[model samples]
Target: MARSSRSSAPEPTQGRFRRILGKTITYGLILALLVALGVAVAVAAAVRNLPSFEELRRSPTAQTIRLRDVNGTVIVSIGPNYGRWLKVSETPAVMRDAMVAVEDRRFRYHFGVDPIGLARSVKVAFERRGTGRRLQGASTISQQLARNVFLSNNYSMARKAREAILAMALEWKFSKDEILELYLNKVYFGGGSYGVDAASRTFFGHGAEELSLSEAAIIAGLVKAPSRYSPTADAQAAVGRANVVLDVMVDAGVITPAQRASAAPAEVRLASEPNQNSARYFTDWAIPQLDALIDESVEPLDVWTTLDLDMQRTATASIQSNTPEGAQAALVALDRDGAVRAMVGGRDYVSSNYNRATKAERQPGSAWKLFVYMAALESGYKVDDEVVDEPVTINGWTPRNSNGRFSGTIDLRTAFAYSVNTVAAKLGDSIGYSTVANMARRFGITSELNTQPSMVLGTADVRVIDLTAAFAAVSAGGKSIQPYGITKVSTAEGRTLYERAPPPQNILVDAWVAAGITDLLQTAVNTGTGRAAQIGRPVAGKTGTTSSNKDGWFLGFSSGLTTGVWMGRDDARPVTGLQGGAAPARAFADFMRVAVANRPVEEFTTQVELPQWQLESDEEAYYGDPSLEAQFVDENGQPIELDPAQPGPQPRDTPGDGPGPDTADKPRLDRRWIDEVTGSGGDNGNRATGQRGSGQGGP
Candidate 1:
């Protein structure tokens, strides 16, 4: 009775204090809870307000492609190893079912976040993962899409939270089927693949539509961790994953136990070489062209160019088979309009990133004589004009012929056809270095030409594209053209932001002048240094070699196509005893034969102004390396003339210099750079007077 009385009879001040303390504690707890709730809401709102999946997926560096042969065979898939996508219109039911069973058992029923799958995944995570991957993921198809398309390849709670929010948003915006499709299409299933369709064909000989249950299950198993369970990477691991998936499906009652037992792993037919790219180099080059012409917003555009599949295959085969064992080769083909049809960057592109055909800048050797002779021919010098091939000195440098024994007197055509370097240098001198440089520019050899007299002998580091365009110009009646790959670029709905259509150009050279030039080129293959480049068809072309046997090149053309081939190491190392006519010429012949195999045979005829095989000066003058006199010009050396009266069908204007954004200062490379560069002989033995707009090798 005393204890009850004491409890009830608390002093008024003490009781008031106790009551106030209790109320204050409760209020503080409530405030803290309210603040936490508000903070969580703010974070959810921020995540929801972030960029959408499509916006986050944009990348300027992602190489987009639309590659097709002339006959419309998609010889290569289009992408540069990141953020790739492909379609699957009709896929294997077994594959689809396996995906549903393995990735999300109730995929057909869920909105985006599968509550039951997430619960199951969470339950399994606490179980650990050593004995064949027990730890599971709450990632549904939508969550996986959020991760693959938007987030980076990282594992974190923050990332997972973002994935959950985005997945929810995606489910709200898109159908469940659409979410599944995007996830399947966007996922990368290891071994240089993206999308279920690409993965199916890569792992199995069949498409996604033809995948067996085992195959489908195997692919689905890759979803958890593609590299860890790559069938090609580790068959045992892949089998283990498949078994685990089968067990899970059976346990979940998605499949019968007998069906699970019946499922067996099939042989995964991997590519011969993991990096076996059918057209690696070609595809690499093609991506840049597409990106340059089209905007990122464009989609579903298939670019059909002049690529010849047969020719490309044949060229690759020839280079792979006939090269000097470890030596590499690249090949390129172009039509009259300078549209590249087929481009093999190397013997095997996947194994090597070296683009021998397009990126290499090799000394053209005698192949450069084409421009020198073109300059001479246009400078009123005839192909039959006599020139001295004997030891000639220019600017204190003596130039020797490739054979080391020069004919005392030979016609300019004979000298060029024979690949005589000294005589070609002399003609460059006699015709003025500006004339030769100018001719090279017009021919589209925009790689900086050297002002040295020996530059006429093809010492410049020009690419295969340059050679193709220059040769194509000769075949195109001397109409200047830039090589084009994409024919047209438009969206799936046919909205055209960029349509690849090159403006036509008139003849840059007289018909007779070009005919005479090609006449010599034909002779170069028929009875001269380029005899190795001869094909079954009537062809005209030239072979090029570089100093120290470092680079070998063959540039040739028939009426139907102009092609170029190069062979060398990526480090620019010398292939001693190798010449252009040996490997490169053979590659060119093989590629051209396949490229033009189906084309109607055509011939070069008189197209524009006729030529007058003018005479040469009868002066006993030095050709190379004497008095430092790099260039000698005829009286009338000037820029090419355009006939206003005989206007062409279309006039392709040069990239006009406008009120452009302020350009950065481009530092000049000094003249004696040859001595400092450690890559040439006595400053390249070059000393030609440079002309404006020639892109000549020197400052």
Candidate 2:
């Protein structure tokens, strides 16, 4: 009886224990369901803002403006330069296999988020918790694409949830091949490049369609850390990373061990590093102008610029070699039609991208006098007419010459050649400062002019490009021009988008006025402050030096090129003994000597013959003397009377007199060899047309 009772008691105890176990199981199941529901809600909330499939598919890639020289050589790329967009069928089998093996071994089986990879990554994190190693991520190719394209790389649970949700959405909306294509086409490579084709071109000098197995492996390995494995950054590290990719490919059964062995040596040959980055100054200036031509809907563009690569190199070297220490120098050279051929913004673009050539506004000093002299010439003043160089005052502002003591009563040519401030001030005052400012505007000087008497002495700030264009107009025999850099803009497939229109041959000044100013410029270069700029040719130029030598400038035209150089401290601090005739003129001569070596020497137009005027009486009339009137004689020495009411020797050619036939013969550069080498069928791969502007270097 006692044994039976003990057994019954144990049965009841066992039954009680079973009831407690059942309750524990029910609570655990309820808690697990609630947690799962919470997680589902959080994921749903995180992904509510996700982009739709069509929006994601149509997401814009970083479009680049690839700048090319006149000869079709690439100058530089602006923005993240992407290569050709490729499809899965177009991708090489070897490249695909290598990329899959290295980036995501289970890329084919993953439904978007790879649970196996996540589990393994978790195990590793726990194993190395105290090792001070960075926690690794197990992002599938789809997850990576989602993060790269749609999500930021914030390390948070919400980001991870969104990434996973987006990955799944991508898998649902796109086929595996489409996902792979997007990933390969959108992946980031180093050196401001993106995508397989761009990366291949950047690293191997070819496209992804032609990638070798080893090259494919090398590029595939860059996904881990692009900068770390970039061949340009470190060749040895790149080789090691590529070998690792080959080993992974072998393990994944994509490539055999034999194939891996052959590619293990990583006999990868990288393309030569681009040495044309020195042209960034030109690219920087030309890129903003590109937006005005094409809209965002257009494909990536190949911009054919007006730059002469050889001339650009020479200008850069000359500027770098001639620029003074602790000071910056900028140079802008234009063709006769005002096409920018060469520009150097500063001593070193790496140190500063300030773009002094196009952006810096510095006082042009005597270079500003080009307008004053043109005004004088347009007002019927002869180049040989006499002007007193004594100190002059206008509007209670007294102006002194740079030498502080000017020669008494010198011819206009002598006064101009010497850059005498007193004569320039007097000329501006007599012609009405407004007239001088208007003259500058007519010649394409876009900067605001002070219109004060000091403006005649170049107190106004101006861009080097504008000043250079102004000089180019004078060299073009008074035809106005707008400075331009791009000649053609087209897509990679050779569809032309924007082509620079031929410059209008608008006559800004009379031919006689241009000739008279040219005569003065020639005298300056021959026997005056700009004598150092003599390049053994008939050069016509002017020199400008601001007060205390804060700014120096040399502007001139020769061999059908108008170039301007400016040298000064960026802070406007004075540079010791920095006159326009010193470094700026020497640099101009140095650059021009080589830039125009092949071109035939061209001479300035003949100076217009003017009647000998009575200088004393003319001066009296210029000073507003009502009693005495100026007298003039014809070239035949016949006495003539001047009209006080009517100014200037003759009326300027009206707009109806279309360009007046002083146009020089435009020379087109022969690009037969360039076509043969580029296989561009004479269009330079961008279908560029109409040659470079009208005169000197072109095509």
- Report the number of the highest-lDDT candidate: 2
Residue 651 C-alpha lDDT in model 1: 23
Per-candidate TM vs. native? 0.54, 0.56
| Candidate 1 lDDT (Cα, 0 to 1) | 0.66
Write candidate 1's Cα lDDT for 83-138 as tens digits.
23433346555566677777777766775677787777767775654556543566
Go through the candidates in order and give each one's C-alpha lDDT. 0.66, 0.78
lDDT of 2: 0.78
Q: What shift in Å separates residue 537 of candidate 2 from its native position after superposition?
A: 0.6
Using TM-score as the measure, which candidate wins? 2
